[model samples]
Target: MGTFGCCWKIFGVALAAIFLFFHDLCASEKAPNYTFMQNATAAPPISYYDYIIVGGGTAGCPLAATLSQNASVLLLERGGSPYGNPNITNLSSFGAAISDLSPTSPSQRFISQDGVINARGRVLGGGTCLNAGFYTRAASDYVRNVGWDGKLVNESYEWAEKLVAFEPPMREWQTAVRDGLLEAGVLPNNGFTYDHLYGTKVGGTIFDKQGQRHTAADLLEYANPSGLTLFLHASVHKVLFRIKGKPRPVAHGVTFRDATGAKHKAYLKNGPKNEIIISAGALGSPQLLMLSGVGPADHLKAHNISLVLDQPLVGQGMSDNPMNAVFIPSPVPVEVSLIQVVGITHFGSYIESASGENFAGGSPTTRDYGMFSPKVGQLSNVPPKQRTPEAITKAVEDMKALDDAAFRGGFILEKIMGPISRGHLELQTRNPKDNPSVTFNYFKEAEDLQRCVQGIETIEKIIESKSFSKFRYDFMSLPMLLNMTASAPVNLLPRHSNVSMSLEQYCKDTVMTIWHYHGGCQVGMVVDRDYKVLGVDALRVIDGSTFNNSPGTNPQATVMMLGRYMGVKILGERLTSDVVSN
Candidate 1:
């Protein structure tokens, strides 16, 4: 076989070995007893579950696994199973997995009202199936702020770590990133630890040593198959409600459609403890709630949908941790790397880096500037004169040179960890199949813009640091036809940057989301501390949507921790000695 084919065959063999190993580990426990396919033919006729969880995503998978330990549970996922999907199992396909815009791709790509391109997972593992795979325990302050018991939170983290999280092997590029972060004055290096702290540290990742990704779906191995039923490609349209002349409405069941458009209704078994939990991510949770008529009455009325509850905050206060980056082109090849090292600054910014062949393929360049399109160029305030043939040719040539460079070097990503600006989600149409309108309102607050500028400035400082000198390239040496001066370099800045180009305008033009969307159905506003939606019984929101604020990092770890916490609470279990000691 050719090299690529040989590699693929070996990868398949390795993955099979890993699967067998994990299967043996779960041998003492019950294997997942659930049904998953394209249709709902295997669904129980009674359709009664002690707990019916929507969106078998990052949060829903683990939560269902935990709850099924004691009660009958059902999980409904809008996408197919993650098992054997190369896009999900192979680390090399990370970019393509998230960027794939095909209707059947696991990721559902959407453009926000603000014109930013983003995506969310439609798969069983949710974001964990699509995200960059970085994992870190939520900061201690985050636990305290959420009013979670510290002991329980710690135990919950341990439970998740034992399943999917792993310590990544340090690569050459990652070590350089660590040195550069420390050189940027991020502070005393904390070495390697999963604890979120103010310094550079290596954390856990879901990618295994064999370069294979293990998703949240793997946690379902702990589930009792007899008690839990999982249905794939089952899109839930709305949460069914019942009112018996009471002031509040109770969630009785859910109405969903199978892949073949067959509709099914799965209700909670009649019991005081039976419930339906919505874990459909930040955008999805609120959209589902609004679709079910639990949002602002006025907004619901405008859509001509009868209101079941007058809760005004169901889809308000959406926050996505916005990110801006500096792509450094290197004439020499760099080693493949993911987000193993991270720099946490005190000023509400987190710095991270990624390097690999995947970075090279995804980087913006002159030849592929069409990806930005006329719309983005116009929104960027690009002057008509700049579109001249001569300028366009020169820009394309420069971009080609960068692309042809031996390696797709590293990228410095500055994420506004604590953004003050808020956004909201609204219905586009009442159709459950249609995507909701998401307005991030990024950089709306003056302080938010300033924070982004600070982050960019920090990135510049890191690039210029002596520790980064080895990775730096001499762009000045390239054959350029444009007016090139040592002081000015090339005119790459936006209008906001005058002599230095508009850093402010550049931010506006280039900013993208890190995909850590949260807080649409926030606590104290839409749900209570116990995750119960206000004015609704037998229903709860248990995903990133329930976060009152961002956890200041990649949110997969925290999302899983929350799922485990909620599962324990629903089971009425106290913190065990083993859990506490771990």
Candidate 2:
């Protein structure tokens, strides 16, 4: 039908070989460092904890570890442990977890209302376990805008960096992409650093020299062993609250269910400071707030969940950085790599690349099922088993053709930095495990569409650059390729087909996700500057959910840094209170 229309399910290449340039800092195999379980079954049915953190993901694990330095902490994760999972551990089998689509898998698949297929972390390390392991801090402007203590922020970052962040060993494909970015006038090769800067730069990664991933869960090793208690597969039902005779409902505890569906209650120790913190991520935090009867009144009434507070901003301002890409096939085999280099444009956009991804990493035991998915935006609605008869036959033929060049290609992707366009998240069901319906409203704003046009044009320059010519496949001028051209300019947009496609239309049709979505329960709306939930006591949401504009190329590093930053701040507050009492 369309050009490479059936190429969506074709697989990526294996790492024909890995370059060993990094010194091995890995010590044996990193497992869960804290006390943990599949469920809280070993504990009493009703237990009291000074702090109950509902998630063990990118932010939750570090937050729990940091808070437990002095205060007793209980961390609840809806997913199982990330340990011993090869799909998540190996860099080669990168896309495996997201492709599995199984209930028990660490990466949970959810198609947004925008028809964009995406995955959420369902494991202890959270998005860090699911993401490409790119690690970079937010720009200085981002920190100032968030109103965080600059010094403490730096300190917190160092603490986490010492444990998890790593300088990736850049190989062939990534090095080419990096050079091409510079040649395209991205300028100022900032070299290896985690700071976000306006130039082509190499950022950090969680995957070490051994190609073994060290996730945020590894940060738990710093946790005080006796003070922290971690429970895996502990799905939080709703936050427990006390509303009687109070100015605002104060969160007291949380009700959760074991994997066996056995309900348990964990309460907070009586204090203004002791509280239930929800670190369930962007989609999850807002969904959780609504489930706890703490969202817009009208929406809550529809589901028959009584409103706790008419804090209408619970799920507003949801933003996802819209990503677009160009996959260039090479005549030569490409080395395997995740995100190692980045180009931060002054116009608030970021460019990055990866190669030789093994598609749907499949099960650790089932390696044969791995196939690299060509992220054709039009195929977002198409599942492998549900393709049209014509499409299915076409896909099979395309797959056979792709089988030859799978290892000889790579993707250079670009995403807008702070998308002004916004969306919202709402509950489709009351079940905690169920993903709430969300619409990112990508390219809703004309400015956002313009940014995509700029980003894509920049991508064209990279493909045309001398550094990338040897590696790039002539997939046609992007506009002519997407058939987003009306009258070809004879030079750039040659008269290919009389398809009435504008660049903006190409942007809209082929939009994909880099998975850097943030907002919902954003600061000043749902949470105070200190990340405490506004108009509510003893309840705070600490995760990417609090970001109005997502920071940096990848948001995981900033998110992990946030966990440590807030932990130190909270601990200081607790110590001050104890000192005053003494």
Candidate 3:
């Protein structure tokens, strides 16, 4: 058999049985009928809604759905629906959606100031539509630290989980990866859990046995469709604020451009409880704030935007969890998998793996995941936009020297949790549609580099463990393969080739984003404990933008949970205020 063929047998006895059960359960569930959904062009030039939500994404969809149970809500999405998109709905074509370079692609690709290629969600379901299907909640300590009620958090998780999450059916490669993690002494195996534990475990997935992805957009099934006005391709340009209030500026309305280049305005109704919320992701929330004159006064002035509030921390404290990986080219073709198993270390790092064809495609001549591929731009000392085909192949080919085997193997990856390193974001132009310039400054702090070193060491141990020996060529560790470059060894690290290589420099050179970036409109900085924007009335920021750190290994579950939790809280507040008013 060829290295990349899939004719190999699928599952062991236990796994095959598990797969059949989940296939029946998940295949029955489908996306909700969004009866209130419409294109932005269908909206009236001026509209009034009890609550207006910008960005119909991961958090916004649930929030709007929940809020609609009592009050009228206007949900604005900058991108089209994910409902009928095969690239997003099917797991067989895992990498196709995000890798599509078209202007209308559901995932928006951007290179950070750190020169790392990254992507952000552009579809209605947000990053949940683009991510590998892992689903896990924040740790118990994380909940308490953030001052959330434990019982309520669990309830919220259950609500979201029941709709989308599933017990992933493990295949051969993932099962072996699980055993290897245990063999490396990441001990006390907590089998099949969603809690963030300090041991090896199998977690929940958004993909079911039939390979269909259930995204955050699926949470809308719980929504009151009658009261929810969902408008797709509604690009919010600026937040409308009533600046002449007594104590601080108040958010009253928003101005948005519809899909056809026509402008529309939506205002909050005459009630103190009515408000506007920014549920855009980490990047979009801060960018919209700055555009609306709520960010740093000096930075806003650079583009001649009138200052609404001089909240200097609006775009401060940006972060992206730095990910490093060791790509292992198996002599045998491995079963296709996403992140199903994890090894959480005592130190702040996570180990996860994925085996399949390339995210972009399976063609041997093409580059795969940029993080795992040989970045010709780095070797040639040229920017990514400046690289050519001939220069790219010649410059970095010597470093990695990989071949078709790369298309057939899996990657063991590490991502540092709660990195101390930080960076800031700023506007590239005044236009809200244009991407802003941002830098994560990965490994900027010395401690972050040390964490990366520890993570790399753990990966080495896993690679050398007894359980994993069968997968490697001639029972060689990653380090051994690089040393004996004679046999076309799959060089995981391009810049350095031997055991004596500086782990620190290797970490810096090979750092990539796992896309768990958070903290632009952070809690206590831009928003309060209730997630309300500081110094602004009738305004709040929900979504990953308000997070202090990326929760657990995956933030999608918690991010969706927050939307439901806060919606309940806000609804309660409304009821209490009505009682007092009466």
Candidate 4:
């Protein structure tokens, strides 16, 4: 048989099996009566509802669930059902989604913005449904530094743990990545991964035990709250809030336009008791705010968008991590299994089963958890290179000699990322269709540039460690990124907003941002400690955009935690205020 025919037969059998299994489940257990609809008419506005959350993604899902407890809530998502989307449902074949949508088209591969590669999802679950499923939490010091009440972080962290069922996979899947790093002495002992959580070399992958990803849609579906209404493919264009000399301008509703240019105003039925929350992704949320005239007055004027509130910090503190991928060729095929390797569990069961463990903290299984800082156990092959007393003293002396800004940068690294370069996120254009021009002014700070050099050096050492002695792996050497003649090897560094530098070329080469954008619209700049967009009433932002500082991690779980926390605060305050009035 031809290759095409053979593959087709295999695919057909797999599809049949999936359908049969789900059919059996449907027979025994009751699935929610959630029907996928498109371009549906607005539901009758009976009276003022509790909350109207826009952009259902990582944060929006849990927010909807939490708010739906007491009052009626509405969730608007721009995508549809993720049931059969080839990219979302299948776990083993997850990489298939990374490929271009068009089959047999090599030229139409997954391209990143400005060539900086990163994964972004468009389905109901948002990026979680399509991401690598690496579960991790944010560092604690980073959270405390945000200047919010300690209780806020504590409550959110606690609630976030329960809502997402964040846990690691089985230990079998961790592999020897950590061992290799340890053997190479790439990871030191002093690096703190999280608060009171020490870094360790535990090799495994944390994934949803169900062989599928649970997204916001899944959570909402499982909640199956009759009071909450979900509107898919409904793109919110603007948030309409009244601001004519009131104690706090109430957010009435939102104005959204469908793909067909048909605009509709979704308003609360009763008085001005309802509020609007914008949980759109970093780029989309800020753009929506700007379009609604809640951004910088100067920039809004340029876009011909009238200024509703002169919130200078609206889009000012934009930041993102410029990510770089180091593809390590495995010496042998990776073993695959579905035995609940880490602390994670089946999505539906996890949400339903709650215990004291759920309330304490979400990190139940750390077997395959993603490590933000290098753990010594995970670095089994690396040699011990503890900083000597003399070296520590000298390092402190060197730190004292640095300028305050440079010192602050270095201190942040010592506390959070150890040593890594910094970057900036820039607004590309006002045109929503055109992707925001993100210029990660990576390797911009001299201190940060030094950090990049050190970081590369550390990664290189880890790859060469004795832990990988058994496996003969191929090492991809980074090319010289500086000004070179045409005769040199093809440089893969163009896509990088920052580049690596030898000790000598540190002053010259510019590297790419690691695709880590945070701090734009930081707490003081964009909003207060509560995450409300400064100067705007009834509207708030709770996404990666509101980060006061980079979490120095993958950022998904952290974003999830923040969303849950902010939702609690918003809902709790509203509930209490309503009670007092009544």
Candidate 5:
């Protein structure tokens, strides 16, 4: 065989060997059979519901819980039942379970016409049950910065915390890394124990004192109201709406399809009295709306989808947190336990409650000031105007500098967060049966480069700190940065290759992301400040997609809060109308 053929053969052999080694690991545990057997007894169908929530994710659960209190609620989930699914409810190793990325129960792998997309939860509790239980609230200032109703936002957040039982999982968590965290000055103080978290390092919340995962499944498991009907395995194909002479169109209902090629319609029962809430998460919600003719008119036309009520803003703004992580091998590889991985390390809070040159002349809200807001603030220093090819090149150079040291360490860290990115999802096919095309144009944004470089530098500083010294962590530079006379693109070397490079070269190949994807439907671009679709009536999107700016923190809390706030607003509107009519 030729040299290329030889390499391919070896590569194939290696892949096959690796696959066999983890064959069992690759396969997820089989989920329960919720299949309706023909010729067998069929469960009673939900003939009608006052409210029909499209998803069962973090936002969906709370929406169902709150709205179903007095009104009849029907929750249609495309995934399997999470009630007793071991893969979902009992999973302790959040990282491992999600890594499976397979469809279980009624929820099959969500695919577009071309047939591939990121993982999504198709179970009863949706993504909330499957996602990592990292409950960090959006930085309060971000809520205000977006011009959203702040005090009311906080109130909504507080309500969400109660409904979902938000609790820090620090009490029983006991990890040695946590001690290392303390030494490294990364812990935030628990207000219950100290006056403030500012300066005092602390761990993020992972679990509660009760040792529960605090999953949405766990939160909404109790006291399910009889009015809410949960229909598992019902995949929404399109949002059904009616257009009138009024400036805004009326949202009538949704048309959905089941796994067995079955089609059904869940109409709005309360008439103008009821509304359609799309909380189908960042990806699905926008796709469903667009398929039903609710996004940019031109794009929908290209897909041959008939226009019902051209909302134009339906799927324009989208944003998410970029994630990056590394599996640091403990020097001694001690016997690992739950406490070891899921401990809390608190960092002191920023006392920015004061105005003007505060906190040692550092902008309290800025990271330079030591206060990292989860929801708002520009993390990247790259000038917005420089978000072009030339700027992207510069950013890549900067990233190389930050990641150079990481290569020296034994473990290879992958940048899950892509800096300098603006990506969007498009309808691959007119058929709602086919999923939408999702392109996470990571590293496509010019500013992403600078932000990633800063992230790398920050992480490196933490590793070099006195506290982290106890772990004997060292930098691992990639070999490509080594002096080369050729003027070519700085290619990334194979992560598995046994090689070493100079710090300069290592910096050239470094990349990272937070795995937080936000912004396909641009915030403020499509939705108004009130989280309402600009051109559509009775249609509100309450999910991560509503985020105008990516909250640097985990988005679960923000999304949940949005659901709560939106629920209250929609309900309040109804209540006011009733009072006026009376």
Candidate 6:
């Protein structure tokens, strides 16, 4: 009997091994055929593509997938795939993912000319692979202003949501934030809606129930694999222009370097519709244009780049939302949280919070919860008209002071959704690998500073509300009040002795970017309503750089929606039932 049982077990094990081998083969067949370690030997010598999309980021991935439905599309990304990176896939490693500072990490961190630290995504999924995973549809006014078809935009939002968006499971810290926002008069309590509104609401997130991040690259699953070719680590240097003293320049192909540093050129096929799209992001799109001699003639000349088109607006009119935060340390443990709740105030400010314990694992007793700074722009080398010398000098001084402050506890991030001031980005050198000089010119306008002050006051009110009274504590013998009294009027300045100077001074010094850079290649100025570059044919700039204005919220969803919208337009297709009701 024992010998018979052993024989049966052996047979079962052999059968299981055979089944696993077949399963592996099937899985490999279904996986997208991405070119790994691309080199001269790997890529064909004169490859032809109907459409070549640069920068496989937040906007590029979806756009390429959508365009590949009928056309042969080539999507080139600067960084490798995001598939097995623990820092990118895990929610707890959110800070380290962006703050890694490694050259090969998915994120490329850089400091602005104004001395504020910021980072942008370099991976296949772009910023979507590295951001806080917050997702929300663009405001209706933004849709109308950008001349996007409202119905189509809505459909595109659904398309992206179905793939990566998810409703977060609320936890302790998020619940407290929602209640406090309501108590502070950001009312109506819209309750778990993705629509952008002027009240507290639980929006969508890209992280699913398992806390695993689903990036925009996942949407490539819907792509027709037979028609799409994705080349990872294929860094595009410039758009090859065919200019024979013609009135309008034509883009014939692109020059890119593979991971092995061997140069390759991929040209557009012989079709009138064949084109190259630059979705290299707010900073990248402008840099590429300038490198290809399509930006301001004077700026390009300074860098010794031969001018193709004197499109002055190519790298101009840059703007980014600035953030300011106030950290409140709590000795007690706070629940681990991301941006599960948001408070949109009437004063053009958005309030969100993140738990420190969620990022830095430690015992509950040592965890700190503090409100960080509001989002704001940085001053550039050539300061704009609005950036006064006083403001610039004060900003440098304040950044130094804020850096020295102790970091403890969970903090609220107050971001000004809209600002009147605008800055510009220009190339420091002609090298495509060199980071551009980005100048946000934050608080150039007094109104912008005033708006920031209003946001700071609003944050104070929420922190003072009874909803947060449970976490209140004292410093020395005095209560940590954030320097406000219940009887004080809204306009009254904070009386906190710990504050360095006036509220405006504090704002000028501590302001930082929420990394929401936009308007480098604005719609009306750089690209037409259809996103085609004005002075150049067979080229379009799609990405955050094309945004006419910031979307007043996290722009990941809007960027993806725009990609889908453009792809549908290029395909010359209307919203079918399958596309709309996703």
Which candidate leads the pack in TM-score?
Answer: 2
Q: Largest lDDT belongs to which candidate? A: 3
Q: Write the per-residue lDDT of candidate 1 for residues 1-582, one digit (tens) a residue.
A: 132222221121121111111111101122233453334555543488889999888899889989988889889988877766654445433333432446667767666777665667777788776666788987898888889989988998898888788888887677877888888888879988889999888888887777666777877877877778888888888999998786789999998887777778999887777899999999889989998989999999999887899988888898777777665544457776767888888877888877654343324443322211121122222355666657646544544543234324556778887678898999998877678898888888887788787777777777777777677664422111001111111122222223344567656755667778787899999999999998989999999998867784788898988898899888873234335556
N/CA/C clash count, model 6: 26
For each of the candidates, give the backbone clash count.
4, 6, 0, 51, 71, 26
lDDT, candidate 5, 1-582, per-residue tens: 132222221122111111111111111233323222111012132245667788877678777767766677667767655554443343231222332334443233342221112345556555555443444555556666776677777786666555444334332112233443345444443332201122322323334454344444433443245666666667778777777676667777777666665667777786555767777777777888888887778898898888876666565544433322222222322221221121122221111000011111112222121111111112122243655556544433433332211211111122223224455677778765455676554444545544444433334444454544443324422121111111111111222221344332233332222235556555577667766666777676777766666552456667766766666676777778888888
Clashing pairs in 1: 33-225, 496-502, 497-501, 497-502
lDDT (tens digit, per residue) of candidate 3 on 1-582? 342222111111111111111111111234567799889999999999999999888899889878999999999999888876655455443444543556667777677888766668777888887777789989999999999989989999999998789999988788888898898888779999999999999999988767777877888888898889999988999999886646788899999998789999999999989989999899999999999999899888989999999999998899999987666657777776778999998978899887654421233455432323333112223344766667546533532444445445566878898878999899999887788888888898988888888888888787787777766666545664323221121111234434566778667656677778898999999999999999989999999988878899989999999999999899889989999999
Prediction 6 TM-score vs. true: 0.82
Taking every candidate in turn, the Cα RMSD to the unseen true structure, in Å, is 9.2, 5.7, 6.6, 16.0, 13.2, 14.3
lDDT of 3 at 352: 89
Stretches of model 5 off by over 4 angstroms after superposition: 1-46, 91-118, 148-152, 163-206, 209-211, 221-224, 244-248, 311-313, 334-420, 431-434, 473-513
Query: Candidate 2 residues 1-582, lDDT tens each?
Result: 232333322311111011000111112255754554445666568989899999898899889989999999999988877776665545444444543557778867677888765667888888877667788999998899778999999998999999788898978878888998999889899999999888999999887777777888888888998788888888898997889998888899899988888988999988757978999999999999999999999999999998899878889999888876656656566766677999888776788887653432222233333333222212333455765557634543444444344334666777887999999999999998999999889889988999888887788888788887777546545544334212211111113333455667666765667778888999889999888998889999999999988888888889999999999989999999999988
Q: Is candidate 2 or candidate 5 better by lDDT?
A: 2
TM-score for candidate 3, please give it.
0.87
Q: Which portions of model 3 show Cα errors greater than 4 Å?
A: 1-31, 357-406, 475-477, 480-499
Question: For model 6, what is the error of residue 526's alpha carbon versus the real structure, in angstroms, after optimal superposition?
Answer: 0.9
Cα lDDT tens digits, model 4, 233-351, are 56677777777877755667887655455666677655334577788766667777777777778877877887787767665555444322122223343333221111111110000
lDDT (CA) per prediction: 0.70, 0.74, 0.75, 0.44, 0.46, 0.69
RMSD from true fold, candidate 2: 5.7
lDDT (Cα, 0-100) at 563 in candidate 4: 66
